[model samples]
Target chain A: MWQKLYTWLDERLGLGDMYANLLDRPEPKGNWWNTLGSASLFLFILQGATGIFLTVYYTPSPDHAYDSITYIMNDVAFGWLIRGIHHWGASLMVLVVFIHMVRVFVTASYKYPRELTWLIGVGLLLLTLGMGFTGYLLPWHQMAYWATTVGTQIAGSVPFLGEFILKALRGGPDLSALTLQRFFSAHIWMLPALLAGLIGVHLYLIIRHGESHFPDEED
Target chain B: MSGSHLSRRDFMKAATGAVGGVITAALGIPVIGFLIAPALREDKAGAPIAVGKLEDIPVGKFHPFSFTITKVNGWERTASNYGGFILRNSEAPDDILILSSRCTHLSCTVNWNESANAFLCPCHDAKFGPEGQVLDGPPPEPLGHFEYSVDDQGVLTIVPVELKSEA
Candidate 1:
């Protein structure tokens, strides 16, 4: 019954061909280090999934934000574990992406034909940092508030467009409900959209160029 | 497509999917439950909190009062500090008003200015009069008023009210 169904779908959609192309690609001889890229991608997906769950119960207002988080931690079943994974996963994603970049750089894989892939990877890194910064303030706790104050102040110091940038980022002279709403939108919508687009390009380039061959022993 | 003949790859593929589905269900059920549990829980109501004695606030002046209220969210209980002002109106001695210190514009804590004779918001310079009415600056409306009652002993009790945003 399953074979019949698979044959019918494959005839119409070419699923078998696509699956073979995706899984049976050729690759360089390398050690465990090659897995870091896949690991980073996995972590990114995990973050997106967990973030959706958090948004279900998170109230973005200052009055209820902290309390909502407290409820998530204490009241929801497995809330602590899910939130913990998301919180720790964010830091882990950043760290793994950084290491992956370093690996690419050390192997000189960013040179020549692979330069566009390297550039797209850089874009992904910036988006990841943007996600972290915007997400840091959703809880509306004291630490989140003060840290955002300092962070925005730093942005307020830029040369020509500093003041405008600060106001745009915060929605006013101070961090208020507008700031919370803006950050939440950026964290969940804008940054994710940008990251997904860049990941698509990055993956396309990876497949097009093939994984950079491990450095030859003689060279 | 003979039922009696199963290739090793086909057998492995079926086995892999079956095991993966089982493992996914084992993990996914608890996570889905956790995500939905908060929405299913009953809403916890806030109770009236005792601020202090009525006499502590002098006549014709606004005095700041603070108290901690235990808020229950789901299974977690948290004590959050709530602030308000007690005013003994000299014009209407019978009318005592308790106003929340949060500003109407941005919800920043408003402090009473003795020299200026108004409540000032440090964030955006919004000002409110002693009776909690908007005096000047960027505040869209008057300060919020909390529901309160005084006991026979003159102990003032205030209930925290969630302010409805005008904007």
Candidate 2:
């Protein structure tokens, strides 16, 4: 009976073809370095899951942001673990993505038909940093506040368009409640959407090109 | 003759692309404005704030005074605390200097260390002299100052805008 059910679904879904195409096919003999890409993807998903859990208790406002996080840490069940994963996961994802990029570069995997993959990977790295930048202000603590002030000021130092860029970033001339609100919006919605979409394209390109062989000294 | 090669399928594709572009612009333009409206709006300056009575302040000492500025940012109103050290140069009403407590480095609050005779920032160990001059550390400029006025009733009112001191 189970065999009949499996066969019926497989016929309609082309499960056999999918298994052969997606999971079975492969190229280069990968070592530990190859695992970093998957590890980065895993961390991204982990961050998304834990971030969703956090939003249930996290209030994005100057008045309540700090208190809400306090409640999450102190009052809610397993909230510490969830937030802890998210907090540490962000750093881990950045590190993993960076190392993965380095490995690809060193192995010369970005050459030939895989150049587009490198371009998309660069976008992913930037988006990851954007996520970190926007996420840093969500806690609304002193360190976050002052750090962001300096960070935005650094952005404001662009030769000509500096003032406009600074205003666009902070939503005003100063770091007020608007800054916090906008940063929270970008952190949870805008940057993540771009990251996820680019990650999808990155993965598709990876599968299309197949993993490059570990480069040898030969021409 | 030019129109003869245009097929109905081609027309359909063009029509679909036009519709999609129109739909995108209809939603996109307003969304962009909504996100960026605050940046385009003029920043409102704070009102002149009264810190304290001028008679009570001592000469040759840094008088720490704090005031709250209620600013409406987006949908919320936030009351932010701002403070500065008022140095009365002498008993003369016009002989006064006010330095913002915010360190020039990263806006961290600075303290008037009487023993050191300078303002010390706890965040980066930046130091400023009595006249708000940058003495040591990473602050690119001196501590800012506020514009002020002494009323007939001897009330000290400050404009609250931080004027950057030239390095």
Candidate 3:
């Protein structure tokens, strides 16, 4: 019965062909280092899932934001676990992606035909940092507020355009309700959308070129 | 056309269509509901919040007032607190003016300078007079005001309206 179902679907959807062409690609001898890219991908998906669960409870305003987070931590069922995972997951994702990039760099995987993949990896790294920065401000606590103040001020210090950049980031001079709203939107929607798109391209590039092997002494 | 004449392929196709339709409806309805639920929600900003007694605000002085107003954003209902100042003219005690502490220039909370007799924005040195007029500095216009009313009990009630930067 299972074989019949599989054959029927495979005949219509070309699943057999797809599996053979895509999943059966050759790779260099697999090692622990080879798992970083997949680990980064897994962590990203975990972040997205936990983040969605969080958005159900997290209110993104200056007033209730911190209180809502506190409620999620204390009141909701398994909320502490979820929030803890998300909070730590963000840091872990960043660390993993950075290490993956470092591995790629040391292996000289960015050379030859895989330069675009390296560039996309860089974009992904930046997006991950952007996600971290924006997500940090969603809680609207004293630490988040002051950290954002200092962070945005650094952006504001950029020569002639510093003030404009600062105002753009904060949605005003000092962090206020608008700043919270802006950061929330960017964190939840804009950055995620960009990250998703870039991740798609990054994955496509990886599949297109196949995973680069560990550098051999001959080359 | 016989009652038991259904072939294996025909039976599978019928089952697939029924399952597909059911799955599609099951998934699509919730997605559509999630997309439209926010629009359908009644976004109530809550009733007018009582700040304080009218007489408590001394004449010729700007008193800071803060109140939490329940703001409904989509499905999430959260209480957002806001800050403003109640200014009474030195000579005209009856004429009470309420101004939002948020500066028009950049939305920073402006502080009332007793020495300068002006509302000073620490971010950019923008100043506004006791009457909420722009005194000097970067602010293009005066501070915005919140609509308020004094009840029979002498308590001041302010309707937390949208913060308009335009005067």
Candidate 4:
């Protein structure tokens, strides 16, 4: 039964073989640029862990939110550090993810068998950027407030669906306390969960598909 | 440069080249630093802050007394806008209320109306009962409160709270 469970899990993840193959194969031996990808993963992990700690004390209500943040930053043990990790880690992830995408593009690794992997990678990249943007406003400070208010207003500027997307984001015609609550919930849960699943699929695709040949492959 | 003559050793060197030398020092260090800066920064949270004199606050009137706070939020240093309000009680000599200027409705500025005996929101005509309860207008709920203290010097001090806005 245990063997069966292992097999079932192995069949789903297949990550061990994927790692073996990637290492045995030379293309993924990787270079300094590849560290950015590794760094990105590290940042993601940092975000998730610190985010959990933050949730322990975070009050999502509009009334208590700013104070909750103040509590986290000032009152809690290393609260500011936790928030900083979550904050800076997010920006770092965004930067590295973009650099990874650019590397893939310049190398033309997006072609052929890697197309699916690249597509998922691009999707994940966009998701990372969205995550950064959404999380920025969570602090609910003067900058976060006005910036997000302007951002939502920009979204509402789109023809037809503008108001819809804006309303969906803000949870109202005018930005309200509800808007803050909704964004907070989605930032901590919805977007992260989606990114996690997508990242898993992305990793699986990379493992199965293997690394694309670099431009120097023939040389 | 021949297509067929590359050795595994040469390939390995080429592969790791991007992760080595100048690039490692120039990019890797900063990348790590940037990612970790937030966690590395310290905060002055829980540190008691001193505000203004309790005697200076005139009876039956509100005065805005602000305290300078040293705050470390993630990688940035934020110094201003920490103390927005330190409302002195109408009748009590030392009673003070620290109300967030933000309206409960949309986090806009709310001022104390001595005549109306309420907090008035200029953004949407919202009114709050003297104690920060919602009285009339668009504010979804009562206005918020800031943790406050009257110090030994009789200074009214308020801890700065984050302003809430449309998510």
- Deviation of model 1 at B105, angstroms: 41
User: Model 2: runs farther than 4 Å from truth?
Assistant: B1-167
The positional error of residue A136 in candidate 4, measured at the CA in angstroms, is 1.7
After superposing candidate 1, which stretches have Cα over 4 Å from the reference? A217-219, B1-27, B38-167
Model 4 C-alpha lDDT per residue in residues B75-110, reported as the tens digit of each score? 335665533455665646446666666676776778
Ten residues in sequence with the least summed lDDT for candidate 2 chain B: B30-39
Quick one: best TM-score, which candidate?
Answer: 1
Q: What is candidate 1's lDDT per residue for A135-173, written digit by digit as tens? A: 999989988999999999999999999999999999999
The TM-score values for the models, in the order shown, are 0.64, 0.56, 0.57, 0.53
lDDT per residue (tens digit) for residues B32-99 in model 1: 88867755665444667788876667887777888776665443476766688888876343478888
- For residue A170, model 3's alpha carbon misses the true position, in angstroms, by 0.5
**TM-score of model 4, chain A?**
0.85
The Cα local distance difference test for each model comes to: 0.84, 0.85, 0.81, 0.71
The Cα error of candidate 2 at residue A218, in Å, is 2.6
* Shift in Å, residue A47, candidate 3: 0.4
What TM-score would you give candidate 1 relative to the actual structure? 0.64
Stretches of candidate 3 exceeding 4 Å from the true structure: B1-167
Predicted candidate 4 versus true structure: per-residue lDDT over A177-199, tens digit per residue: 87788888788888899889988
Lowest summed lDDT over 10 consecutive residues: which window, candidate 3 chain B? B30-39
